[model samples]
Target: MKSSFTFVCCMILFSALIKSQTSLYMPLDIKKAYANGTRNYDGTPGKNYWQNSADYKISAQIFPKEKLLKGSETITYFNNSPDTLNYLVFRLYQNIYQFGAPREFGINKKDLHDGIKIHRIKLNEAEF
Candidate 1:
């Protein structure tokens, strides 16, 4: 009788342990927790872009010719997400031509009466 009782207790304890290990806990104040850098979306707080580390950099250059404009931009995107992401989407901006000339206005392509031009699209080596 004692041996059977011990076996039942052991089974109960083992089941509780397994349940605790597999169960996921959801915090109540998830947003506040993230703002405090406790529950960061990237698994860690200091490694994300908000920490301002020297692991990556972004720069752009533009040159204008007599009738055309040329530009080149580079982005050093560091792997900061918890999951290893391969592909990334980047938005490219261009100046709209009005009356056969480049117009100086805010980034309102829809408001412009001219067409849109895509400069370049690049895929990083990490994407491969």
Candidate 2:
């Protein structure tokens, strides 16, 4: 009985694997990564795979009674790729509430305000 049950389970799993492989799709960029030896055909990281990393030091203060919050962050990013980077893109999710900003969900009138205020930004000890 145990052997029969195990065989049935294995058959089901094998069928599922075959079905999934038939529907597998690889985007152009992912295909490029495979060609570049950054990823293997078996969906594993290849020996040449590399990923960028960053370390952040952040400080914040909250004024509970005034319902205000302030924060600052210092990020040290390391570029592990062979190519030199000209610029970096950062996402500010809260900016979705900013005036004239596009949003998928509706926002209450009273809840809407200036999304984020950037006090200062310095890179490599030089202000931009």
Candidate 3:
């Protein structure tokens, strides 16, 4: 009974994987770039290369005894290219202590605590 159930589960999972591959979405810009010959076959940058960058100012305090961390940050963003960015991403390193976050190497133990408490974010001295 156990072996039969496992075999059925595997068959269902395989079918799902095959169906998902065909349903994946490719954005319009990528398709247009390929049609216009701006996108190379090997996926390297073409003749017109562009990138975006930002500058960050951060102030933080940590309390080891209370196991607390507090911080504030400001970002100055530069978008030289015509590409529109709907969102920005930031990473908090203190949250790495969590139980199940992926790690490249092995770890001996994990701790549970209030993950990276960010108090405030401001842009041009206006609270965000």
lDDT of 3 by residue, 1-128 (tens): 99999999999999999877665577999877777666765797765656778888889899989877677666789987778877667776856766676767665563655466556666557777
Q: After superposing candidate 2, which stretches have Cα over 4 Å from the reference?
A: 1-35, 40-44, 99-105
Give the clash count for model 3.
0
Best by TM-score: 2
Q: Residue 89 in candidate 3 has what lDDT? A: 79
lDDT of 2 by residue, 1-128 (tens): 99999999999999998878565687999999888898998899988899999999999999977767789899999999989999988888878878778888898876676778887878789897
**Number of clashes recorded per candidate:** 0, 0, 0
Instruction: State candidate 3's TM-score.
Output: 0.44
Report per-prediction Cα RMSD to one decimal.
13.3, 9.9, 16.2
Instruction: Give the winner by TM-score: 1 or 2.
Output: 2
What stretches of model 3 exceed 4 Å from their correct place?
1-47, 92-110, 121-128
Runs of candidate 1 exceeding 4 Å displacement: 1-67, 93-128
- Ranking of all predicted structures according to lDDT, beginning with the best and ending with the worst: 2, 3, 1
Error of 2 at 58 (Å): 1.3
Q: How close is candidate 1 to the true structure, as a TM-score?
A: 0.33
lDDT of each: 0.55, 0.87, 0.74
